[model samples]
Target: MTELGFTLKVFRQIGMMKPILPHKMLGAGLQLVKWGPGFPSGVNAAAKRFPRQLAIIDDAGELTWSEFAAQINQLTQALKDRGIEAGDSVALLCRNHRYMLIAMIAIMQAGGRVLLLNTMASRSQLGELAKRENASLVIVDQEFLEVAGDVDQDKVILAWADDDAPAGLPSVAAISADQPTKGHSKPARNGQVVIFTSGTTGLPKGARREEPADLKPLVSFFGAIPYRGNATIVLAAPLFHSWGLINFGFGLSLAPTYVLRRRFEPTRVIKDIEEQKADALVVVPLMMQRMVDADPEVIKKADVSSLKITASSGSALAGELANHYMDTFTDSVYNFYGATETGWVTIASPTDLREAPGTAGVPPFRTTVRILDAEGKEVPRGETGVIHVGNDMPFGGYTDGNTKAFSDGLMSTGDLGHFDENGRLFVSGRDDDMIISGGENVFPRELEDALIDHPDVADVVVTGIDDDKFGQVLAAYVVVKDGKSLTEDDIKTYAKEHVARFAVPGKTMFLDELPRNPTGKVMKRELPEFE
Candidate 1:
């Protein structure tokens, strides 16, 4: 569709959904448009419009939009007083909590670049990242104090702690205690948020993103899902991820009540959903898998009836897992497919899951998905090729001066996928992970899917290894289900029944557990080598 048509469609969707919204909320959205595109602007608008409404609920307790805004402004002023000027880097290394959100808003509002650090990163990695980004300050939780690495004593701030506040550093609570409630003066430039890739394939690269020029993506999201003003959400996904940040950004205009937990405990998550009566859930695929794999009785007893949307991303949602989630919870699952660099490319609605089991669904209103060959030519629908995506929000190249190869104005997503006859997209594997055996090309996802179906197999990953006969053959690393046993032959027989001959694993290694990153992505490079 043309830009004019896309805008029209968005306006129409908003018109139809307007009656259900709070009075004058459309005026607030228009304010967002006029204020250009900055997170602080959207948040301040929400605070002014709905001052008394609940904005955040975390281990630190609840805060209304008015209180939320005040805390953000307080920290923003504090950063300014400490000589942290606009465009300076303020690295945030805390877990999911109200203070983390406050720090992000404050940094952006004060015009400081916000660097979201993965909490699981080692001290070496953290130190390297801080130096690479030229961080002016590092804010961390008390738990990470020992691992904060070398930084000026005055540049570090403790943002969250459960017990008594630590000495020698100004805690977030202390800084905000006597600070002003009003927002600080706007910065010279709208500081951007820097997100690092998950590093599943290699070393993580930092991806910088400026605020989008248009609100179409955000509007289109509301049209696609059931989010609205005052809706309550349990954000179980880590804030460091793209999916979690997207939800948080949406809340600026929609003013949804966010329920967050620092650590992910499957049972506690379910209990929070039940007690909070949350309307939606924000999560990664692995979190949903854990929820589905919970005790059937516990799942059955949980009051998930209030949940209208279950948004998942960050990894592939297996077909079986999607079906199981939809079956357990009234068809409320929505699987989103995108990368850290490209933003959201596709979303699988509940209906899409029912029709096409493992599909990532079609492109959203303004986005485009193309499957192209090595020569940059669009391939036939069913033929697997590299996935290229065009969207309103594209990453501004890597901070290390690395550029991704692009074709016809669309950026490569580094994924291999294909579109079916119904126009639904299916991710096969990474572009570099395809295996060739006996002159037949194979994708590891197919073999991995087949292996995961066995009752004894808990998780699995298939890698291509060198072999004299086929040049490159498949190797399987299997993690058996707890208290369950299966022989290598049993898995081989199951593979023979389910997939092509060339796709079957030549050798299988049983592991007690698969090594995964914090994001639940299997680090194949860290896997044990074959004997």
Candidate 2:
């Protein structure tokens, strides 16, 4: 994008936020130059500008911006005392809480890079991953002592402890308690933030995002969604996922009061939103599905009317789920479509959801989306092809030094999608997920959408299974609605009516729920094999 184009986009994005004073803007810019882009810069700036403002509210308690900064700076001092410096890697293995987020800032403040480890990952996997990634230290929660055990005990620091540390091991609270409270010096260069992708086939891949992330994503987000400055945001999603991390990092730039929960209980989510009077709610689609599945009586009792926007990403927002959520929440849903590799690609507003169910919506300011065939040629608007995206900040590269497929300045999203005549993008499924059974191509998204529309079908996923006769065939793992009975023949018949015979799954398995990572994407590797 040209300089003029970028300036207009930034102006439009800034215009969407609740107004800020000139001095505050200047202060933020100064922080940006010093600390670069990320939570630390935003935290320090907020401390100066809104010291008494509530910065975070979690299960433990609340902290104002001033206290929040002081705690991180103190922790920074402790890490520096331990000899942490720029470019050192510190893996964070913890759940969503104040300290987990605080540790991320402090690590960077102390010039240690942050490697976010997923809580859902097995202890061995987390340990192995940290070792493979060459992490020198780990900040873990008390609950994950077993995970921490995989590492040398001396290098571990508990970010959250229910009580005192185990066997006198250091904890963030302990280290920071004795440390002097003072501002930390800015690192020569901003520390990098590493996020691992939840790959379906193999062990996860690590993607490193160098700090001060591309402003394009921030511009893309605030340009479409009205997340006002200093508003309250309820982040029920795990802080490790890219989507959740985005709400914390860029979302912090807005200096909003973030409300976090240690766990996501659907009904409790309603209560939190109601109690917090949150202006924005961030979640993945699975959370929304469960939220809508919660008892109607509880939802009706809660007053979540203050929610101006509920930003959702991390997985496909099924057409049925999107409409149902909007119908219940009064059209406040905005579904974001992108990858950990690419930030915000498209945003489906309530109007988009209502008009075209399952549409990924259109690209936001200064972002571009294209449908390209295998040869890297652009396909027509209504044709299915690889979905490629171009924005200011796409993924830098995997830690293993591999890069994603790039063509004509756009990086592949590794998903198959198409655009409507109206310019709305619709993601079908993973590019690698497309199956050819008996010479008939099949996309699981079409069949999943069809089955989900059935009132008895609460949730479903269709995967291709190897078969002797056809080489591969579709297999469905479904979750039936409460008090409903859906049989194999019933599902096959329903699928036959809605999809091509060849596209119908040869096997159907019913479960109470699908196996999903914290971000809500179905863990295909965890699914039971077809019989």
Candidate 1 deviant stretches above 4 angstroms = 1-35, 199-203
What TM-score should be assigned to candidate 2?
A: 0.94
RMSD (CA, angstroms), candidate 2? 2.4
The lDDT leader among the candidates is: 2
TM-score of each: 0.94, 0.94
- Residues 1-531, candidate 2: write the lDDT tens digits: 875576465554443233667786677678777776677888988876778999989888999998999999888888888888888999998888889988899888877779888876666777787788778789988889886677877888888888555778888888889777678778866777889876554567888876644465676667778676778989987889888988788777677899988899988888888888888889999999889989999988888899878899999987578889877875888998987778778998989988998899999877888899989999987999998888776576888999888899998889999899999998889988988899988888888888888889988988988888988888889999889998999999988898888888889999888888889888888888765
Q: State the lDDT of candidate 1 residue by residue for 147-218, as single tens digits.
A: 685666677889896576566677787877888877566679777898876554434678887788767777
Summed over model 2, clashes come to: 0
Clashing pairs in 1: none
lDDT of 1 at 25: 65
